[model samples]
Target: MAYSEKVIEHYTNPRNVGSFAKGEDNVGTGVVGAPECGDVMKLQLKINPENGVIEDAKFKTFGCGSAIASSSYVTELVKGKHIEEAMTIKNTVIVKELNLPPVKIHCSVLAEDAIKAAITDWKSHQTPASAQEPRKAQES
Candidate 1:
């Protein structure tokens, strides 16, 4: 399959290609695998607790060029964005941005899934009372 120029650029020079220490408190990690193609990706985000903003991102992907490009692009997209805003990034946007063909759509889906998974993991680690107090107060 022919990749678009942007995809090639990202694939060739992927950004944030490393990992944080396992116990790093501010880091959130998401790992996803695509059984259809046996592709695996691990994505991580370092969030600012006070503002819920992503201060940094990293990824390791074992997949096709499209998958690598998708993950790389997503990391860049989410940096400096609030976690909720980052969650709004859809697979369609990745596909459009990467100019991925129909066959490569799944790669974009994996990227989106990875983002949500990381966010979920991050939320899970947060103190329940602290995480929920704002919402509870709003509802009451």
Candidate 2:
């Protein structure tokens, strides 16, 4: 099958491709795999607690072009954004931006899950006296 131009661009020149060698020992790691679809994605991130910003991201994906691109895009999206802002990023944004097909929508969900997992992992590392639970979604 032929990949879309966006997928081709990201897979060929993925951004934020490596680990932060000495990133926080508490780096958050999220792994999602869908056997039926033959896709597996692992997203890891290093976040700054003071600012709740993603400092670095690395991913290992096993799947088709859309899956690869979705993971790649999320990595780019989260960097430098406050954790809460990153969490607010919607799959619709990914879908619209990547122009993903209906059949591949789950790929965007996987990217969202990876972001949540990474943030949860970051929260887990906080000292007992300092751990801040992720705030709930506030409806407007």
Give the winner by lDDT: 1
Off by over 4 Å in 1: 128-140
* lDDT at residue 80 of model 2 (Cα atoms): 81
User: Per-residue lDDT tens digits of candidate 2, residues 50-75?
Assistant: 77788878888888888889999999
Q: Tell me, what's the RMSD of every candidate?
A: 6.2, 6.9
* Worst 10-residue lDDT window, candidate 2: 131-140
Candidate 2 global CA lDDT score:
0.78
Best by TM-score: 1
Query: What is the lDDT of every predicted structure here?
Result: 0.91, 0.78
| Steric overlap count per candidate | 0, 0
- Candidate 1 is scored at a TM of 0.90
In the range 1-140, model 1's lDDT, one tens digit per residue, is 78999999999999999998875667888999999999999999999888999999999999999999999999999999999999889999999999999999999999999999999878866776645544334224
Whole-model lDDT for model 1 versus the true structure?
A: 0.91
Worst 10 residues of 1 by lDDT: 130-139
